[model samples]
Target: MSAKFHWVLMVVFVCGCHAGAASIAESFTSYKLVPNIVTKAPANVISVKFPSGAVVDLGNELSKPQVALTPSVSWNAGDGLYTVIMFDPDAPSPSNPFISSFLHWLVINVQKDGIASGDTIAEYLHPYPPPFGDIHRYVFLVYQQRERLPVKDFIAYSTIGRFKFSPQDFADNFNLGDPVAGNFFRTQFNSLKTDKLF
Candidate 1:
């Protein structure tokens, strides 16, 4: 291949990759997830596909996830243990999320790439934004664990009320550091939602 042609192809590939990354970053910032839940936008976008063929895309407004079990989460990161946390930063109401960051799911000791075999710290709670509330952001964050989080120590996290949970504090206590990959979707209360828990 001519050197000029090879260079042109490389440029196209590079630009394509950059645009994909930029979209995720822009959406996170647009939805305020950058400053509210995470200090920085994660470098990778984690894939969250639900059983009902629904995929969670950054900043997209979704109805209920269509399943009670945790959605399938996958990421293309290094081989090692990982942790996944899903929460709502806008609990009760986005304008007044006093009980902010209501935990929806927590899985630790996740093998690289998938959450199917992970230890479940908190079973997935179907999203049910309060009837009177505005849109809510359901965020999924994947952290590369420096070491295996001791199962016994994290078991109590499930028992603790899901409300008033802090993903930042949990990461700090466990030394999980910043998330390597993340994605979020916006949802709001629908009175006609067939899956309403309340």
Candidate 2:
């Protein structure tokens, strides 16, 4: 990929796979962000964008049929990339209230700014989901950055304050306990950095 255009990642994972049951009828499997999700790309600037149409209503949270806005953004930063993350805080969880879970909906990276709408040239990212799980809510968020941010792992910090993680910190945390954390952490941390678009 040229510096002007690089591939971003979009990912999805579910829970039912481990539960040993088919996905819930109305549960959210995954979500996708398309070019149409954004308003428009700049002319002189080659930029990547993501789906910002997601809306979270505690009343009626997101499900499989109800797609959340997938986050897409520029990767090289020169052309500009956007990253988005969408999740359900109230997703149907087990008895544990604090032990919140996350479902990855959009872990995609757009190649260029002018990719035609409905074009599937983009890529999809699949994190870990109980081997064959299904029907899980993933929060989709988008972050815009100036370059491709590389990380080693994913670290779960409830807030940004506990410890402002650099890309490296994130990479390590994700993989520390969950063998599946490194790959997912790398992608998720990259998205978080792009969020500092100013």
Candidate 3:
């Protein structure tokens, strides 16, 4: 083979490798679960562990798993209070989401690398996508807070049926700025009973 031809092949091989890696990373960044309201990328990635010791990935597809309690989360936020949000942006159905971004969980004033405690504003609501509905994206977003803010009213606001909630608006209103870390998982109704909840 000619030296010039070999060089071209090597270049193509390297570019292909890079493209594969980029596509994997883009999967998380391009996730439509996170409303265009908040920044797409975060400063860091947070690790979330289910009760069954399963660590959640960016777009892990889970069946109706038994997520009775809140998943444990850890992040490197240094010495600052942080806010955690878990919501399903594809409520009811993705095509016509009248109740978009249904808030599932909210914890505030969390310390670095810690699980939510008494500071939980809204309680965790396990994912329960309706049968035959589109897969729902359960997003977990973390934000560094400026200070401890009153969230009781905000928690109440989430309970109202068909209430509109925007993570971007919440961050802006509380001056939380961009998210520090985030991750999500996808779930849908399990008619076959193939997967077990953690």
Candidate 4:
């Protein structure tokens, strides 16, 4: 190949990699998760793939995930105990979020191998944005646990229900520190069907 053509290809390849990383950071900032939900962008990107083969991109809109096993999450983080939580910061409605940061799922002490092996404090609750409300951002955050969370704390959090649940608070209470990886997707009510195979 010509030297000029090779240079062009290299530029494209480099830019593509940068864009992939930037998209994850940009999406978190553009969605205002930086200061509201998390203090800083996670260092790693998380992949959440549902049972029907739908993957959660930065902020892509997806149909309601049907009742099924917790989506499989793949990441490059090293082996260690992890905690995964999913919540909707735009609960009720983005404009009027009387109940903000509604927790959808919480699994603690998850092994590096898989989330299913972890202790499920609270079962996964699928996205259920209000029919007339605007799109909701369902965010999943993964934290590297320093140590096993207290069993008592798990019982307390589980009893609090899903509304007004704060993942940050949970982290702080347990001293999990900031999340190391995260992912989010937007969704709204759709009665047509769920578990889309795309």
Best model per lDDT: 1
Task: Report RMSD (Å) for each prediction in the order shown.
Answer: 1.9, 19.3, 6.7, 4.1
TM-score of each: 0.91, 0.28, 0.78, 0.83
- Answer with 2 or 4, whichever has the higher lDDT: 4
Clashes by residue pair, model 3: 65-197, 66-197
Deviating ranges (above 4 Å) for candidate 2 = 1-78, 91-95, 106-138, 151-198
Candidate 3 error regions (>4 Å)? 1-25, 33-37, 193-198
Query: Could you give the candidate ranking by TM-score, starting with the highest?
Result: 1, 4, 3, 2
Candidate 4 per-residue C-alpha lDDT over 75-174 given as tens digits, one digit per residue, 9 for 90 to 100: 7667778998888899899888888888888888888838887888777877767778788898989999998776566765565667788777877878
lDDT of 1 at 133: 62
lDDT of 1 by residue, 1-198 (tens): 999999999999999888988888898888888777777788789998888778888877778635344688888878889999999889889989998888889999889876777899888888888778688888999999998888888777686657788878888888988888899888876665566543
Q: Counting only residues 3 or more apart in sequence or on different chains, how many pairs clash (N, Cα, C under 3 Å) in candidate 3? A: 2
Count steric clashes of candidate 2: 44
lDDT for every model? 0.83, 0.27, 0.73, 0.80
Which ten-residue region of model 2 has the weakest summed lDDT? 177-186
Model 1 scores a TM of: 0.91
Q: Candidate 3's residue-wise lDDT over 63-165, tens digit each?
A: 5664545788887678878888888878777777778878888888887767645387677887888876688887788898888777664667447722466
Which number leads on TM-score? 1
